[model samples]
Target: MKRLKTLASAVVAGTLALALAACGGNGATTETTDEGSSTAEAATGSTYKIGVLQLTEHAALDASNEGFVAALDDAGIDYEIDQQNAQNDQSACQTIASKLVNDGDDLILTIGTPAAQAVASATSDIPIIGTAITDFAESGLVADNEAPGGNVTGSSDLTPVADQIDLLQQLVPDAKTVGLLYCTAESNSEVQIAMAEEALDEAGIAHERYTVSSSNEIQQVVESMVGKVDAVYAPTDNTIAAGMATVSMVANENDLPVIVGCDTMVEDGGLASYSINYYDLGYKAGEMAVEILTEGADPAEMPIEYLAAEDCQLIANQATADEVGIDISGLEDAEIV
Candidate 1:
């Protein structure tokens, strides 16, 4: 078995206690839930339950959640979506994941790596669909990306980190040193950060690392990077994205252009981004989930999908460009948002 995440495994035992308590209060079991789903399929088809455990609230993640629901709606898949947000807390993901499992959801859609890990540890029998995750294999949510070989599978939101860094250089030509701001608690952030560093180093640019363990320290941590770096590069991180307003305020006020990994961050007040569409990413995941439910598709054979490179848009915050004194008029290819 793959090693469960430290925080997620720490709460797995407690999840069991809740699991036991749930059985005494209800007449349902996992087997019965499946039988009921079959019976519902023969009748009104409204008994299907889907658990949505989101890591946090951010425009990108929210768009993904919306896209997921939209897909189910368009497909006429009537399901009782139990939406749950962990509020960027790993422990909370563990608890919610356990509850979803104990509640015997037909499937679980985890919006981030932490939520995915928590649910993956909670139950291997229930199909888990993950989105907004950088790497399923790297995060240990699956045995392989191309072939999941297990119950977990979904689209990977591995943004073009290297290309984003290159665009950062083009956007901030005078930027000699860049500050990499991210949350250490987010594994996906670390992956993007490392890729960003490598891309920056290849271009012979100096960079610094600025990490915050939680959202409470975001403003302070971002504030500390003012004079130290010429620009800030924040990856598609849940904690940092949730606190983007503070980040933009600190960096934009200082005339430090922030190049982010998600387009939603640019809309949230960053300078620019070359990122994938989270809505499309989640919609694809929803289709995969639909195939699993309707066609009896096996998650094990499903390869992780991703948006095409052409789908990544070059987005710039026009208001931020005006504030940062960078004339983006020359970059006509970028869509000014």
Candidate 2:
């Protein structure tokens, strides 16, 4: 009878061991999907595969990517990171997203709205974190902002749009018609454009909209409207940001001051911008990622993050101001770049 009891105890211990192995020893569970893809919960203390997809190669986006990686490094998490840039091409972003998903990344970080949307569409099983997106709902990435209610959540680069419009008015107070330049393809840009329109209309400022389909058309579009409007207002549009050289060239030639949405564009030649720090936004996103991956927090319940009001800065480019013959000296409290 004693021998029989010992055998039964051994059998029970073996079953318990199997159950623990199935749980991955860290409350993680794995299963194979119908598509033959393996999906598993993140297990702490194990090396994780992280994939980063950036929409373009602009300074703001680059700073965002840098901050994300820096935060990850600071967290001391063991992760294999694969970073890729789409060069402002949507198709390239799609391909990169698929490759990253197929690579079986534990998590994916997207820099812009396009990249985020691509990755979100590629795989619903993988967690996605996006930064530099203005409105997740407007971008169709999330159904609600307070609670993501889906597998997507991240930081927003939603600078104070109305305040930016007000700053543009302050810079060019005598301006009657402010030319609104942006790309129609980006929904993020569209959200900003609508806000700018409402703000401009509220100020009784007449505005003209100039649309660009791609980077190649920016110069011609800006040239056509340079002399027609008193000043140009560009929201945080990635296509226009990438082609700021041409936009600034046309604006400078016509002595038309340009008010942009971010400091990076100001540095690229726009006269001024009231914006949030993209790097800070990215760093915040990274911290959220660590919580989700290491702490096993669900991203679906994570609230969308934003840069604090204190972190927003006013950036003015002295060279651009001087070239455009705008006197920014009277502007008090602005950070001269």
How high is the lDDT of residue 6 in model 1? 24
Write one digit per residue (lDDT tens) for candidate 2, span 1-337.
0011221221122211110000000111122211111123223237778888888878999899889877887777777788787777777778888989999998999988888988998999899999988777656787766789888999988777777777887788899999999987777777777777877999999998899888889998998996689998998888888889889988987899999989999998999887788888889999999888877888889988877655778889999998989989876778898
Q: Which ten residues in a row have the lowest lDDT in candidate 1?
A: 17-26
Instruction: List ranges where model 2 is wrong by over 4 Å.
Output: 1-44
What is residue 52's positional error in candidate 2, in angstroms? 0.7
* lDDT to native, each model: 0.79, 0.78
For each candidate, give its TM-score against the true structure.
0.86, 0.86
Tens digit per residue, CA lDDT, model 1, 1-337: 1111222221121111111000001111121112123432556555578989877777998899888877776676657778888776666777778899999989999888878888998998999999988777777777877799999999878877777877887888889999999877776677777777777988999999998877789899988998999999998888788889999998899999999988989998999988789999999999999888877899999988888777878889999999988877766577898
Runs of candidate 1 with Cα error greater than 4 angstroms are: 1-46
